[model samples]
Target chain A: MKTLIAIKEQYHTWVHEAFPAMHPLLLPLCNKPFIEYLIDFAILAGSREVRLLSDGQLTEVEEHCGTGSRWGIELSYANLHPADDQQQLLDKNRKFCGGGRTMILTGYNFISYNKQKSYLDLATIATDTPIASCPGGTITLKGPPESGASEKSPLAPFSITPLDSVQSYFRISMETLQTGSSRYVLPGYGSEPDCSIGKNVIISKTAQIRKPVSIGDNVQILPKTIIGPSAIIGSNVVIDNGCSVSGSIIIDNTYIGENLEIDMRIAAGNTLIDPTSGVSLTMEDPHLLVGIKTWATTAILKRKTIHALAATILLVLQFIPFILLFPLLKLQGKWKDDPYMQETGLAGALAVAISLDRFPLLLKVITGKLDIIGSSSRSTCAGKHSYPDSGPLSRLAVFSYAEAEDWPVNGSDAAIVERFHAVHSTPIKDIGMTIKALINRLTKGR
Target chain B: MAFRLDTLNGITVGIAELNGRLVAENSTILQKTCSDWQQKTPFLVFDCSNLDFIDSSGLGTIVGCLRKALEKNGDIKLAGLNAKVAMVFELTKAKKLFSIFSNAGEAAASFAASPVSSKTQ
Candidate 1:
């Protein structure tokens, strides 16, 4: 059987306001991302393939999910139109659905299901009608029901709850913690029940830990700190000395200061939230609370530095050749003063070979305005060009990825190749790719 | 920031109305003014209705003011904090340090009601 999971941006818009830094699908519930729960459910239902459909950007989801080989299932992603109906969805994914029984899971809802329970019976449900549904979402089986075993059968036990607000999210997380690994496969390690801990944890010997707690990776419980009878601590968290955290969630990259007593609150970085009222507060004091910024910004800085260095080298290398050939080419009428330049003769070929045309843009790289290698724009027609300026794949750069890979791409195919590398390439890899781009340009010039 | 003294039920309370963003650039302004305000009357009510944003420095100044007021047997109560400002207080666990009221009038009057108890021990 196959499963098609559809989620619209409209349903998960609350995520933007509450947790602006987090993607809704990646929203953690009891230290497990929300999407994994859905995927697990699909796997439990004996699905060999699952296709994730969303109207929103799914790059982060794709990065997390990959090809689903880890789960031993074929996973794919596709865009969804906001106005697409169920029939349209089936029509768009006709090849994926095929003639086999397909399960359709839609909406931004939490599926309450047990991993131990046999959900293979889910295939016996009637086609095109919701077997189980709530105000949040529905689970429907498509195609003929299990090769004509029976026209209908009762659904395997499950329920869906709407994750519409912070309160619901808190409740669901707490609920999941209380339920533990019995109902779902939560990510953690615990020798005993109702207590899950992740890697690189430093719990102070003097610190106290109560049952029914989920602690994620790289967490530190300082001296005399007391961690919950019901607490969900995310990764890279620090509970300072004499602090007591119970019935609360300390999200990733957060620090709780000394002697602070957090009861039934959600502390995410500098933001503290009252779950019952959905009121969030941004803490103005760093000593008491703050966000632990790890390597992401540092990584960006490092990449920028590398790109700038590479661009600077290119700028210096082309300095003399550009001075020698550029004005000569202009004198010969082969080089234009404007952005659009054509090199047809020896001057043109030498200028192109030395990458003299990219001198102006290399400055942008040095100024940290553009990448050294990224998606390159081209004139598709008269004063018309196509290049991604936004989204995850968009990049402004001196050298194009298509040129780097030396792909014989034309029109839209060039866009496809550049887009692929924009997301996948790293700074060091981009340097190699940039060299390839330069080599390809020199060869093409000859 | 603007400051004025008001006699609330026989207690002289200074009400400091913080305006706009209290970020790093102007946090020192508040810190300097807090010392001057304490000379007149250490008991203060920080009216934060007009405060749109605050950073760690701004919050640190407030905490410093509270500490100074406490040393002189005075108290700093907060009032009229909007949602955004209130969030900052809660995130830093600073809300636990001060007695908050909906308005300056209520916060200042509380000083008169039990001035001795208002002092953080």
Candidate 2:
């Protein structure tokens, strides 16, 4: 069976007002994208192919779900007109429909379904009408029912709630959290009931976490802080010392201040919201409550000064070597002037033997255009070497921090390591990293 | 920025109706007005039904007003806080510091029923 998930722009109008930064389809319910739940349901209903139709741009959704090969289902996307009805939609997507039994999920609604329950019976139901519906949208079955299916037993009932308001969004999230993994396929891992935590979570010894809580990856719970009873802390969040958080959802990239109490609220960045009342307040003072700034610029001037001095010293040491080796390498067809492939010469035996290739990048460090030890340099031109979503901490450097730590020199893991050190490392620490990176480069014969 | 002073049941209660937003630019006005209102009566009620928004500065100003009321053996209570304004109070934990009522009249009436040496005093 094929699934056609059509979500109209009007269905998610409230999401744009509540969370301007988040795409309605990408909204996280329990640290998982809302669309993933629909996809899971589609798979359970025996869908081999899924097509997402939306009036709004589906670029982010396409990037996130990709071809849906991860779920062993072929995923496709199409644009829909706001005025298009059910018949027009079917006519437009006739090629995708292929005249087979199709399940059309039309709305931005939360479908309540237990993962343990097999929805394969949807294929056997002989109905061309809407199987379920709410104010926001409806779920309807199209095409003829399969033959040799049991007609005696009735189909199992399914429920869906319209995600029309902030209160409903909050209520659904809390409901899912309360339900835990028993009814839904939620993210995170837990051995006990009602406690799921993700990777790289740092919990202080004095911090207390009660049951019925869900915490995402890279979360830091400082000393004397209490989390739980009913709490959801998203990824890259930091709950400071002497704070108590109960019955609240702290979104990603947020910093909860010290000695504070967060109860029955939803905090996203600087905005604190009361779910019950649908009230929101944007905090002005960063110390009291603020978004966690990703980059570390506290001692940038000091780091630049140290890097310049180190670069100058290295320039003096390598000046004569570079002058002698460059001409020889150029004559031997071993030297290239490509900016993106600066490290290509380093791969050569002659360049590695005398460390002549690193001399040019030291000039960049001296000019303050690059860090002595940070993230690897990428080209400004469009290509695979260009940095995607160049975050604040992703600075071009002569020597990468990943190399200093002997981690993978490329990919997401390397970027994470670089960002971690960039935010935590001092000028003095950077010097040690530079030395380590230099040693690693020389010892590795590249 | 101004208060509507009224005496209900032998207790002089100052009612301040805040409208629109109480942000950093005009938060000082509320602080000044509440300080002056403290001199006239010990019991104060901030009617916030019309208030739509509040930032951290506005929250601090309210906390300061409560402190001023406390110094004069007086008390400041909150009333008719809309969902948005009430959320700011809850987030900062300022809701715990004062007695909250459903309306200005209720808040004023409660001041008269309570003894002078009650929790606020």
Candidate 3:
């Protein structure tokens, strides 16, 4: 059986509003991303292929999941119209669905299923009804039922939870933690009961951990800190000294300040939410609360080297035009600071043609402060909430990918295009796009 | 920031209504305004029902106001802090430093309900 996981952006709009920076599919449940659980469920249910369909941007999901080689399954991604019905969804993905058995998993819901059990009985579970469904999601089998020669329960025993709010998200995460991979294959290893710890964990001897806790990779529990009794700590997190964290989730890349009482709350960077209390706080002070970023060492080195080389070349190439014309234009009162908005007169036009206006930004790229091609937002520096809950999907750069593709500077699809390039771009391709971006910036409307 | 003097149960309380945003741009104005409010009454109640957003500098300014009030043997209580504003206080542990109430009246009344501080022994 093949699986088609149709999670439209509409079904999970709450995820967008609550955690604008996080892709709903990538939201973690028990240290495993929400999408991975779906994938795992599909794999266990006798499916070797899976396709993730959404009406929103999937570049981040794609970048993280890739071809699903790690899971030993073939995985693909596609887009959908938010208004499309089940029939239309099937019609759009007809080729992939084929004339064989297909399992349709739609809506933003969590499926409570046991991994150890064989859901192979679902292959023959044929009725004109949904196998199992919840408020926002349904699991249905499509195509012809496999020929069975024995009598058995047609549908497997399982339930779905409609994940439509932060409260639900929190509830589901806690539920997953309580289950502790017995029903699902959770990340990390458990040398003891009700406790799972990940790689690079630095637990001080003075620190104490209660039972039934899940800690992700690269976590540091400092001196005299108490973790768990039902805590979920995500990757790259640090709990400072003299703190008590019980019944809380410390999401990826967060720093818990000294002596803070975090009980029954979800801490994502500086934002802390008590789902029960319906209050979410954003701390402006990094010392009190902060999000950490983990960068790939080799990938960053490659990107910086390529960006630095390309920027240096561009700087040398534009040196003469900038030196000769910039000062003259400034003295003539024709040089505009915000040239991208509107550059008037022949001098300004000529300056644009030679790419003299982008000289300073290019120098920044050479200094490794900016990328040769990235998002054009100067204020979207790293370590800020530019991209929100997720890591930085876009960056401050000399030229944006939208400029390269000649998309409208502030167009709606600019984000879509920019994110696509941001995820799939190579440093080498970035250089090519940099040249195109400059050319497009110079001549797109002209 | 707008300040009004209120006499609740015979205790003089200064109530400041912070509006729009308390950010870097106008944070210093809040400090100066608080200094003026302190002259009329050291016990102040910050009516934050109108506050929509705040930055670190704005938070620092409010903390500064509280410090000045304390120096004059007075206290600053916060009232009607919307979820967004309350979040700022909660995250920085600033909420722990002040007495918070759902409305301005209650916050002002608290000053009168309690025994007044002894006059520096």
Candidate 4:
């Protein structure tokens, strides 16, 4: 049987409000996207072809489910209008429906079905009306029923609940967690009851875990911390020292700070949310709650190496010019030397014209102390320094990216430009930026 | 927020009715009102049936009122908590700190039944 799943954006508006960064259908329930459960159900009900129709953008869902080859089914997506009715939907997908028995699943509701139960018989069940429904959506069957369908026994009742609010979302998550893998095909692995753990998990010896918990990959549970009895910790999470997390869902890439207590809540990055109350707190102190860095080390290393090589070449080209101009400029008082500070303003302009001021900074780049083109150096003072939005990756460079792009040399706007390049610029792109910086310096004489 | 005082079985219970949204801007009013209510009668019942939404500041204010009542050797019970308001209490583990009931009368009656009230009288 072919399956048609129609999900409207307005149906899950509450989810969008709560987790603005996540697509409503892609919201993770027990470490699995909500849409996957619907797909799993469709496949189990003897669906070979599944088409998803959404009034909202389906690019993320399409990219994720793609062809559904992993589940050995054909998956497709189509656009739907907000005002589209059942007949209009049927008319639009007439080619895919193709006179075959089609199951229509609509709304953003949670379908309660046991994996152990055989729902393949749903294909043979003759029904013109909706089989089951909640306020959020409905399940309807179209086309002719299979011939020689057994009339022996009754099928198990189908149930679905509208996930209209955070309370319902939280309740459903807890329900799925409590049921474990026996009832649903959940992500992660656990041979034992109520304990599903993913790969590369690091639990400190001093930390305690009470079961009925699900933990995802690359999680770090620090010393003196206690997790679970009823907790779901998503992948790439760091639960810091002396913390206790119980009856909470710590979403992926979140860092829970030291000596904190998180109970019956949901935490994503610096946002600590009380799901029941719809109350949320954005922690200002990064030490209390923050987002864990997830950039690949190999990529950073490659960029740094390319920057260093470029700095080395620039240093060699400027060596003779520095030797010839330094003594003349200093004797004429056009240059002033300070061990801790580099030349700036008129002296800085003369040094750049001769390419002398950047000489010492280029040498520092080869030592891995700086980059060839990046953000300006922030003070090393303990509490007064500021960093770019790209975090540690936005290192100080011999020639600032602001100078290359001809933006203001310093301040918040320059930091933004540096951060944008730090996150997105490639090694080859850095070489281009280096050329731009040299041209800008020669033209501006600074 | 509006408050009404009533005597149930000789125990004065202050009922604070919270309506609409209890968020940062208006949460202070509830806190101040609760403080004044505590002085008149230590037993308090927060009726939140009409409340639709609440943020962290509002939750904190309610917790603060509970603390004030406890300091006076009195207690705060919550009643008529809608699903949304009840969810906030449950998530913060604040539900464990109070005697919750379906309505104000039930909550007020419980205060009268408790042995601490008889002893204080």
Kindly list the per-residue Cα lDDT of model 1 for residues B2-120, writing each as its tens digit: 88999977779999999899988899999999999999998999999899888768888999999999899898999998876776676557888899899988988899889774534
**Can you give the lDDT of residue A179 in candidate 3?**
81
lDDT of 2: 0.81
> Better model by TM-score, 1 or 3?
3
Clashes of 4: 2
In candidate 3 the C-alpha lDDT for residue A353 amounts to 70
DockQ of each: 0.32, 0.44, 0.31, 0.05
User: Is candidate 2 or 4 superior in TM-score?
Assistant: 2
Q: Return whichever of 3 and 4 wins on DockQ.
A: 3
Model 1: per-residue lDDT, tens digit, A62-101? 9998999999999999989988877788899998888778
Candidate 1: regions farther than 4 A off: A57-59, A66-69, A147-156, A253-261, A269-274, A277-302, A310-421, A424-446, B115-121
Ranking by TM-score: 3, 1, 2, 4
Poorest lDDT segment (10 consecutive residues) of candidate 4 chain A: A379-388
lDDT of 3 by residue, A1-446 (tens): 88999998768877765666567888888798999988988998878889999877787799999998999999999989989877787888899988778898999999888887778767676674778788897988888887762455444567889988889888888888998468888889887767899999999999999978999999999999989889999999999998878888888889998877787788887788877765777776676678775668789888998999998988889898889988888898877666252456777777877678788778788788888888766323322332332346667777778777854545445655676787789988998898887777677435
Which candidate has the top score in TM-score?
3
Candidate number of the best lDDT? 1
Model 3 TM-score is: 0.81
In terms of docking quality, model 2 is: acceptable
> CA lDDT of A377 in candidate 4?
59
- What is residue A6's positional error in candidate 3, in angstroms? 2.4
